[model samples]
Each structure stands twice: as structure tokens, then as C-alpha cells.
Target: MTDAPWSHDLPWPDDLPPFDPFDPAIQADPYRHYAWLRAHAPVVRAGRADARLYLVSRYDDVLAGLKDATAFVSTPPGGAIIPGLLLMLDPPLHGPMRQTISRAFSPRAVNAIEDAVRTLVATHWDRFLASGGGDAAAGFATPLTMGVIATVLGITIDDAARMRDWTNSAVDFIATRIRGVVNPDASVDSYAAMRAFMADAMDRAAADRAAGRGRDTVIDALAALRDEDALTADEADGFACLLFMAGHETTTLLSVNCLDQLARDPAALWWLRAGGSPAAFVDEMLRHRPSVHRVTRYAARATTIAGCAVPAGAPVRFLIASANRDAARFPDPDRFDPDRRGAPHAGFGFGMHICMGSWLARLELRLMLAHIAATTATIAANGRRVPVEGGAFATSGLTRLDLSVTRRSA
Candidate 1:
């Protein structure tokens, strides 16, 4: 991780337990450390000196930070904000851009794609069941999610694979940039390639519209809006890229996590199989094992979070995963109880910057889990599950999860 130009000047409580965000052990399973942080140090400094982080683990504190955009802004002062990237913008710019983009990507738009998503999930599940299951992440979740997002973007199957690769690199680039780290493995070429692809897609959509052939895709919608001067060319392209990158990977991880959790708890699987609510089950899964663990925000002004003083321009890491599991907010937070209800989880985030594609993600997850429960009589771990490397900062889920399943006898 590259050292931040800003120094770690926060008062570090001496009795707080040592915590490192990059530590492989903590990354693998951070619940224990999160618990400690919430109990002893709801807000504290962690990470290396150069890339120091003001970590917030308590649910209330994190929620408040996410809500108060004035105090905790998306981008730091004087920081280079990516044009058209909705997540990186704030206030005056963010609201209008978000409103404009919402026209293209909304709940209604997502609902329109439900049948296609269902078909994709059914097809993938069929193939997996026929083969008695394999690596659920690769054989099922990954391709299934890629197909759904590709459909949403109106991209060809041939382009989906390449887009996935580009999305990975782009995500790595973003994560490293947030951490002040220089990722040697990630490439700027990927960003160029993705942007080029989006531009081409928008152009194609525009051409098709000119020819009186509307595809009714998100790209098509954005293209029309662009023609109306509602969005700039850069904004259109950036929205497409963001949707492609954010849509697939996070959903894929959530699907795999659901499956993993099901394999461990037969009762949960049975409950799902017995016509229990997939939406509720998926909701619990999100809280129990969210795909993305943390999000970094810059302190827009000097403030006190959870009673800890934070300097302006400081990088504050809101541990979403930790917040979801906060005992003070959710009784028996550690337990994975689908029926459990209380405060909403921070799995999809909260406040102004909550995930825009959250509804689509939930739809995909619910349908996939419902299909699995309906079709599969048994689910069991077949081998070791491999975690995504260096996913602690960006996203975290199994890269490979071997599972064996038995189809229900019809």
C-alpha cells in the first residue's frame, strides 16, 4: 500500500487490541476483530502508517457517517474525482447525476429484466445439477451473474467474458487507489478498454435507435438520454462501465455466499426448500455474509465519530460487514437467523450512497436461491473453498467453492 501524503495524527487509544485491515487472517474472517473493535474501540486507527485508516465498526456510527454526507464526503478535498462515476461524486453533482442515471437504471427497469434473469439462473442451475455440482462459484454463480448483467447492459455474450476481465482490473484499480496503494497487477489499459467498450455500445444503441430499432436495454435508454443532452458522452460511458463492474461481481459473491451458508446449515436449506421466503433468506444472507466488507469515505470536515475525533481530509473506513454484525443494533447479531428482524443491515450500505443496484442484486439472489432450494435435495461441501485474494479492501467472496448437490426427484 502506498503511503498517504497525510499523516496518522489521530489519538490512538493504548489499550485497543491490534488490528490490521490487510492481515490475511483478519481478512479471511474479521467477525472476531470487528467484535473487539465495536466493544473496545468503536472508532480507532488501523492499517500501516503510510495508508493509515480511521476505522468505524459500530453500526450507529457507520450509519451516521454514511448519512451525513456533509461531514463524511465520498471524495476528499482536492482529490481527483472520476468524471461520471456516480459513487465518487457528492451533493450538488451527485444528486442530479444520480437522478438522471436512475431514469435509465431503476426498479421498474430492473423488474423488466426479471424474466431474463430467472431464465439465466434456471439454465445455469440445470447444468450444475446435471453434473452433480462442482465449483459453485465458477460453474454457477459467476457465469450466471455475468449473463444477467450482460443482458441488462445489452452486450453480446462474446463481450461479456472480456468485460468481466476488464471489470476485475478496473475494480482492483479503484480499490488500490482508495487505499493509496499502487497495484502492479492492475492495468490502466483495462480502464481504457472498458471505456472504449461502453462508448461503442452507446454508439451502437444510438445507431439502432436511428434505424427505428430499439433494444430496450439500459444502454439503449442511456443512449436516448445522451441524445436529449441529459447526459454527456463521458457520463453515459461511465455509467455503463460502472453498472457492468458493480452488477456482476457483487451478485456473484452473494450467490456463492448463500450457497455456502446453506451447505453449512441443513435446517436453513430445509427451511428454504419448504417454501420459506427466499427474499427473507437472501436478506439474512446479505447481513450474515455481505460480498463487500468495507467502504472508504473522506472526512469532509473535522468531526467526532463514535466519540473519536477525526481530522478533515482523513480517510475513514466504514466497516459495513462489521456494522451489520453489531450486537448493540441487532440482537444475537452473530447468529444467521432469517426470521430475525430489527434494524436494517448495512450490507447494501445506507443513506445517500447506498448501492444503486441493490434491488437488482436482491432480485437475482432471491431467484437463484429459490431455484436451488426447489431443485436441489442436498447440498454439501466437496472440497476446500478459496477466497478471492486481496479482496479485503474491495470485495470478498469465495473465488472457488466446491459443492456437491443431489437434485430432487421429480
Candidate 2:
């Protein structure tokens, strides 16, 4: 494999395989390389010469690193590209930021949106069926996820689409820089646009609440926190951007991944149709074909992971994808068996930084899958499979998946 553009900045060990997840070939199928890493070097340093990126592959090691936030920090070496992003902050600081928006995701709030999510799924599925077949990623999955997130954040669907575009641009910008390439202007512009958009959204949400015509929304929650001095305006905007980036995008990927995996396994689909638990199906899918592949942390002090010594302030990467597929953790790890049961997977991450949106995502996937089983007799790939272009190390998902759908006989 070709070296990343930033290799000269911080040379990697020659022994390590030329493994760059963003490389299209590796992105297509990374399991072989992951197997190699797990077997040979569970912990190894890789990335730009200037940036110390240590990758942990084994399941238990990754889980340990994720849970040990004190040693393996969320803040990274320099700081978050976007300040006040909750997922990037370590504890003490992390708790307050998380609590600021936690209420919006409470059990009651999420349950209240169940009908809205189902209606969104059904509406999109109807449109897909009308066309006989369509790209499930864009035509169905993304819209459904974006709609749900938009509803929760009290933003228009159009606004959510715009915010999503900005989020993608910003994420791409940061990913490139992390790889040692420098394309700063566009990504900076994207973050600025998102901040401006979210600020205005908060204003509107606050006005609505004042007028006594308010609905439950993340924006209003953050606005309230800002009023209480629990969060600053910039922090609130950053969190709003996070909601768009993490909340909506990951769920969209999860939906696409579920469709892709189930389409490839007829027996699994049959199980789901024959009264298998949708929750279990989603859990297994998270392990077998997770949307997120890795999460980053910085060594707060000198520490060792998987037996390798890491210096203080070094950047570390936990390979959640590889961890989930670890043979020691899951028997016949590669097999996709919804009926399989045990400990939860690292797909949503581990410990404090574990995805708070996971419950909301699980609810969406469960409902979406159940609805598919009830309405469609079979779904098969009819065209191309376009993997998302970048964020290879971070998320694995499709940008387009054309599928043919057969509706259940009336």
C-alpha cells in the first residue's frame, strides 16, 4: 500500500503493513488487514511523523482504552478542531457538556418520537417502492435519519440538509489534516457556517419557547443551558454541529450498513422475517458491520496499552471495528448471527464517550428493519455499491446502495 501523504512528518515503523483505511481498496474490505494486526501487533504506532497515532486492535484492549479515560484522554494532543465539542473533551469537563444536552435524549423524549420516526421511515419506504427500486442510502436511509434528527433538533428538513452538508465538509477538512495534508480554508469555512446557522436556530427556538408554542428540541435545551450560564454560545453551537455530524450521519450509516449486510445474507433476512427480535438484529449488525470504525484519544501521561509503551500526549486510535470482530471476544467473529448474544459491542464506543445517541439510533434501526420485514417480501441489490469517499478510519458506510424491493402481496 502507498504511504499516506504525511508519512514524512512522523515516519511509521517499517514492519507495519502499508495500511491506510482511507485507501479505497482497504476501505472496501479491511478485515484481512485487521486480522493481521490483531494476530501480530495488537498495539502499534502509525500516522504522520509529527502526529503520534497509536492504533489498538484487540477487543479487550480497545475496550480498556475507551473505558480508561483518565490515561487515554478524549482531548487529543493539541485540542479539538472545534472547541467545546463534547465528544472531544475529557472528564470533569466532559460531564457538564454532556449534561447540557442529555435531557433531550432521555428515555421519555426518545419514546415520544417513536411515531415520528416510524412515519418518516414508512413515508420514505413508500416512495422507494413507488419507484420499484432506488439507492437506499440516499433515497431512503439518509432522508429518514436526517428527518428524525431534524425533528428532534426543531429544525426544518431543509435546514438539517444544509447543516449536514456543512458537517461533512468540516469533517472532511479535519480528516485531511489528520492525514498530514493541509487544506484548511474550506473546513474552517464549513465550521463557521455551521456555527452561524446553529446560533440563528437557537435564537428561533428560544423565541418559540417564549411565545409558548415550543416543542421539545435539542436547540431549545442548549439555549436554556446557555441562559443558565452552563454553556457559552460557542459551546452550544459546537454541540449543535455535533448533533448534526454525530447524531444524524452515524445513524444514516447504520441504516445503510444494516441494509447492505442483510441483503448479502438471505438467511439472516429470513430470520428477521420469521419473528426474530429487531433489537437483536440491530445489535448484531453493529458488531458485524458497524457504522463507526474508530475513535481517537490522547495519552494523558506515560501509559502502556496492549503491552506497548506510549509516551504522554501521544495520539492514540482505538479500532472499534477490529475490536468488534476480535475472535477472542466473539466466537466465529466474522459470522453475522442476529441470534448471537452476549456483551455489547464497541460499535457505539465504550465508557463515558460512548455514543449517547445510541439508544435513539437503535430505536430508529429497530423500527426501520421491522417495517421492512412487514412490508417487503425481499430486498436485493440492483445496482452499484458506492462507499463513502473519506472518513475511512472513522466511519464505514455507503453513499449509494441501489436495491430492488418486492412488496409483500396485499
Candidate 3:
């Protein structure tokens, strides 16, 4: 791919070190590369010609691009537009759709489920602590997050496990698409299965509501909208699928990240255990080790990001991880300081497209951290820390984190 207006052959700063976003090594720990790019080439071209990508790394540039929805659109021109999938929508369509969806999946809905979520957290953590700890990601965080989102969506526990499996496939499919190497064969079947399941669930929700037995779950809410002609059936089903897919996985990673942090830093653990705010810790963790690191947008028209020119229709990869760590935005950017104040990190993104489920994710993290701090005396890593297979291009966190914890004395 051409390196923008810099030259036809070489990357910006001709002697720049080799950088490939898809490389497993780079993805395993991308901060070093992010730091290098932030310092030297905040905006540069990457990938091959057919699937060229423009990388934007600085905090200000990324924020600007995310806010200027017109300049950097969610979907490329002529790309397949999935109805009800808010992530791919922009402007006029996005605003009304989001507003409508928000009515059903509102903060009140999330808040109402707190007691149940807390109970769910306790059940999982109690078991984990009783076992003296195990794979925190799979044993605790994954199931816990899946359960919470499932409850919110009104999915039965029996189906929650299936949803978890389907979510994994969906996430893999999405990651492959972002890398310009979609594998329909590997993920399409599971994706279809999930859509069908959600459709059935929505149908059930609608039926229950008509019979005056509506449970007021997210499904019920969306179904009511559909019945009232407020949302198309396709939109309702698409939104339900998006909710499960987006809600479960990202929050799981964030939970695991908190566990990983507590295990690694005694001071952080002590602060939490000693009654320091889990809210503060969570905010810093989102910045220091965000579960999601990069987001893609298509350059709608010719534009310049961080002084680098981008051509119309070019694919732009905003290095959210890099932007969060930019010293320009955060003092001593490399260090993980829970007490961090001032500019908010791009962990949950920015502008209109900021994560819709961010409030829910934060609540999950804060509760999980607070519980761990209150019950555990010491938390330590018991084995290797495995990074998520896809790298940081989409979601990034531990796939397997073996933790050992000791309970506080009675």
C-alpha cells in the first residue's frame, strides 16, 4: 500500500522499524510499537494494496476522527449494511435507531439488574475462592459475564452456555473481517445459528407480552417496540444479537483485566482491599490495559489526520490503545496509575459511537473488583498469562489467567 503522501515506496520515516498489526508478536504486546508510532509516525499506511489500512495513533487525532462521523464513517461506501447493527450505522439512521434501542436497553434496565448481578458475582467468586482459585478467565470471568448479559437479555441459563459459544464464533468472524481475511466457512454457520436463536427469543418475548406476561427483559422491551411498529422485526433481532455479542465478550475481558491487575500489583490490591475506590481502579485499568485496542473507520473523503493525508475511501485504523497511552494525553503514559485524573481514555471509545454498554461494563468491573478486595487477602498469578488469540486489533486480554487467592480470616 502506498504510504499516503509521504512516498509511494517507504513508510513514514524511511528507517522506521518493521510494523505489522497482524503479526502475533506485535499483537502479544503492542504497547512498545504504539509508543514508537506515537513518537515517530502517528499516521502511516499499513497492510497490502488490496486491503490497505491507514493507522492513526495520537490521542487528539483519534478523538477528532471518532467525533467527525461524517469524515470517518462507520461503514465504507457500498459495504454491506446490517440493519439494527448500530456499529455499522452512521448519522441520521444511527441517531434514531440508538435512541429507540436506548429506550429498551436503558441505564434503568441495567441498574435494576444490579442485585441479581451482585448475587451472580458472589456465587462465581465464592466457588473460585473455595477452589483456591483456578483459570480466572474461563472459570470465573467468562461465565460470570455471560450470565449477567444473559440475565439482562432474559435468556435462560440453559441457553446461556450456547450463547457463549456462539458469541466466540461471532467475535472471531468479526476479527477476521477487520483483518481483511474473512472466513465465512469457519464462522458463518455459528453466526446464523445465533441469529436464528435470537429471532426465536424475540418471538417468544412478543408472544409473552401479548399474553400480558411480559418479563420486561431487554428482549421484551425490543419486542414491544417491534409490535408497536417502532422497530422492524429485523432491527429488533439484529439489535438483540448485537447486544449479546457486544455486551458479553468485552465485559468478560475487562473483568479478567481487573483480576490480572490485582494479582500483579499488591499496592493496587491493598488500595482496593483498604477501601480505595474500585471505580478509580477500573477507569485506570481501562486506560492502561483496555480490553479493546483498535477500531476501524473508512475515510469518507480526503482528510488529514495528525498532519498525514488520507485518501477518500481509505480504511483507517485508530490505535485506541496507543492513544490512551500517549504521553501527550496522560502523564507518564506507560505507568498504570489508578489515581489518574483529567482527560478520559479512549478505552470505551469517544463521541457518538462510544460504547453503548459502557455503563454496564463499568458496573460489572467495579462490583467484581470490590468483591475480590473485600474477600481476598492476597491474589497472585499462578501460571502463564495467555493473551487472546486475535491480538489487539479488536478485543485483547487474557484467554487464560491462572490465579491463586487466599481468603481473609473470619
Candidate 4:
């Protein structure tokens, strides 16, 4: 990939040293770290307490790296960080697995389920509104997203809460090189619980597929794969795991973030409803308060970024929040101005491997925001909700969202 104009602004450190990821000071306000890294260290060595890795904070470098699959592979071939899961595999092999999953996951297919998703959202909305409202995150977003995932996967709505537990266990934690200096065992237990649950779910689905009792599910379609495009057992499991994780988790976050932003800013909300252009608010929400805050890339080969040469076998962290808020690419990057006349930001991502679900995510957020605005009389900050720690990955968002509302007078 060609180097971008913005790459010129990124400067590498001459005296490189690994910054500690586990530092409480860094965790408290990572933006300070992001500023230091993006301006002075495009590629900086960083220690995550016990874990060692390199941090890549700038937008341009991270974009280049994600596009350069040859130099920054997603996963090794036939790789299963856990057995029977192919979502973790790299390209040549990952291509086929992705194709198989795409049959079910792509925007076209997901679009077909829009009515279902909207209905699910309304079902939760009615209940949440009737309950005099509670934790918006737990009461509404969780069930709404959880039902979408379950329904799409050909599961019963009764399994809504079960799927919620599985999704939370699998994703609601940290994932960066850095973390709080707390229980080593808790992390292990959380991961173990998630994997075990998913494994059981996969096993049950697999058996149902063989017995011809799986009903018509994406899992059944995947299980019944024939010709040259079929997945191995582990690949199926891995794909299922990744699908559930991605489908519900990020969708939930983006919806909450969009609604929260709209409630706080009436002009932005008005912009969304007028001219049939909620996409602007959606773009701003993604740029301003992107759900997935950080992502990782391991070096596939030696490469130079922003004039710094990196050896093969190094890991790089991409601070996405910083990238969206980058002044080089976005004017007044920090301010939440949806009407700012500029190019759409890389809130979803740029280059190859860009989020396939970007459109759907935008649609979901728009609909949910529209629903909340139309249904609720008023939305304001009352109490507060803590953000979940992103664990080893700094993408965790909104463990709680305290929202107060009154019915919109019809």
C-alpha cells in the first residue's frame, strides 16, 4: 500500500523503550498516552506489565499495516488459537472460511433480517419503557442485541438471556497488553468459562446438524457445507464464536453511544431526522466515541512505517480512538460536530479488512436513535455507569448507561 499524506506527521522515537501497559496512571487517562504515542512514537515499544508488545498509535501507520496483510497477518494458516475455530486463521486459508461465514454474515443477508431486528428492538423498548426504565445498557441494549444474534443464528428467543451470558463472558473484559494489576486467576477463569460455553454450544449445534434436527439455521447451512468451500469442525466452531461475539457486542455499543450522543445534543438529533440523513450523526458518533477503541496487529514480515524499520515477529497496537480524533485527518477531531464539512472518518476502519458490517452497524444505530427519540419525551443524564475495562484489548465500553426518560407525548 502507498504511504498516506498523513504518515508524514507521525514521528518515531529515537530512543525506543517499552511503556508499561499495566500502569494505573496510563489506564486512568490513556488519551495522554495516545497523544504522546501518536505525536512522538508512531511505533513505540510497550510492556503490558507481564506482556510485551509494540504500540502503533497513528492513523496512517495503522491503516498501512492493516492493508499490508503480507507483512501483518491476522492469523497463521489453519490456525486455531482454540481448536475448531477458523475465524482466527490468516488469509490464504482465512479467505475460504470467511467466504463460508459470509454466506450468513454479510450485509445483504443481515439486511434481510431488518424487520426481525427492528421487531426485537421494539419488543425490548416496550418492556424497558414500561418498566419505568432501568440500566439502559442491561435492560435494553443487551436484550435487543442478544435477540438479534440469537434469532439470526436460528436460536429461540428463550435463549436470549443465555446468549447474553455467553456474549458477556466472551467479550465483556480486557484485551490489551496492559491491564489493572489484579487477579491473574480471574482472567483465566473468565476466558475458560467463555470457551467452555461456546464449545458446548458448538457441540450441540454440530450434533443437531448431523441428526438433521438443527432446523434451518446459519449453523445448519455452515454445517451442511459441501463442495470446496466447506469448513472443518473447528473452523465452524470458531466462526460461530466470532459471529456471536461481533454480531451482538459492537452493535450494542454503537447503539448506546449513538443514543447517548443524540440525547445530549438536540441539534445532532435534529440533523439525523431531517433530510433523511442520520448517517451524519452515525459518522460523528463513530468518530467521536467509537465503540471499539483499540485493535491489534502482529507483524507478518519486516516493514517500515513512518520511517521506522520493524523486525519480523513484533506485535503492534492500534489506538483507534486517537485515529478517529486525529487532527491530521479530521478537522477539529475532538469536537462532536456531525455537520462538519469533511470526508467521512475511518470510524469503522479504512483499507482492506475494513468492517464488513459497517453499513448494518450504521443502520442499527440510526434506527435505535430514531426509536429512542421518537418514543421518549426526554432523555438526560441522571446517574452514571462505569465503563468496563477492555482487558487485554482497550475496546470495552459502557458496562452501564444510566438514562432517565419520559414518554414522548403523541
Q: For each candidate in turn, give its C-alpha RMSD to the true structure in angstroms.
A: 3.9, 4.2, 2.9, 6.0
Ranking by TM-score: 3, 1, 2, 4
TM-score of each: 0.93, 0.91, 0.93, 0.79
Backbone Cα, N, C clashes tallied per candidate: 0, 5, 0, 15
Over 1-410, each residue of candidate 2 has an lDDT whose tens digit, in order, gives 22212223333346544666557666666777788778867776666567557778899999999999899886656543455577777778888778766855656556668888889989998888778878998889988998999988878999988887787778776555443456655467887888899899888888888899766677887887777777888888888887778888788888988888767876767888899999999999899888888888878998887667888888788999999999997999999988897767998999999887788899899999998888887788888998866664687778899898888888
**Candidate 4's residue-wise lDDT over 1-410, tens digit each?**
23222222344344432345555344434555566666765665555434446667777777777667778765532222553344234567656655666665545456656777777767888787777667788888877877777766666666545655555544433221122234443344544554455456556766876777765455555555522336665556556666666777787877777657756766665555465356676777787878776666666777777776655655666677777767778777778887776755566765555675675677666667667656766666557866656455555457688877667677
lDDT of 3 by residue, 1-410 (tens): 33453213434344444677777666767787788778877887777767678888899999989999999998876566676789888898999999998989665676778877898899999899999999998899988998898889999887878877787777666545544554655576676788789889989988887788888589889888888999998898888888888898788888998888888888898988777899999999999999898888999998887767788988898989899999988999988888889898999999899998897888888888888888889889999789876633687888899999899998
Q: State candidate 4's TM-score.
A: 0.79
**Judged by lDDT against the true structure, how good is candidate 3?**
0.83
Off by over 4 Å in 3: 1-17, 106-108, 168-187
List where candidate 1 sits over 4 angstroms from the true fold.
1-17, 106-108, 172-186
Estimate candidate 1's alpha-carbon lDDT, on a 0 to 1 scale.
0.84
Q: In model 4, where do residues sit more than 4 Å from their true spots? A: 1-20, 23-29, 48-51, 76-87, 105-112, 158-160, 163-216, 226-229, 340-344
Native-referenced Cα lDDT, model 4:
0.62
Q: Which ten residues in a row have the lowest lDDT in candidate 3?
A: 1-10
Model 2 steric clash pairs? 9-49, 9-50, 10-48, 10-49, 10-50
Worst 10 residues of 4 by lDDT: 172-181
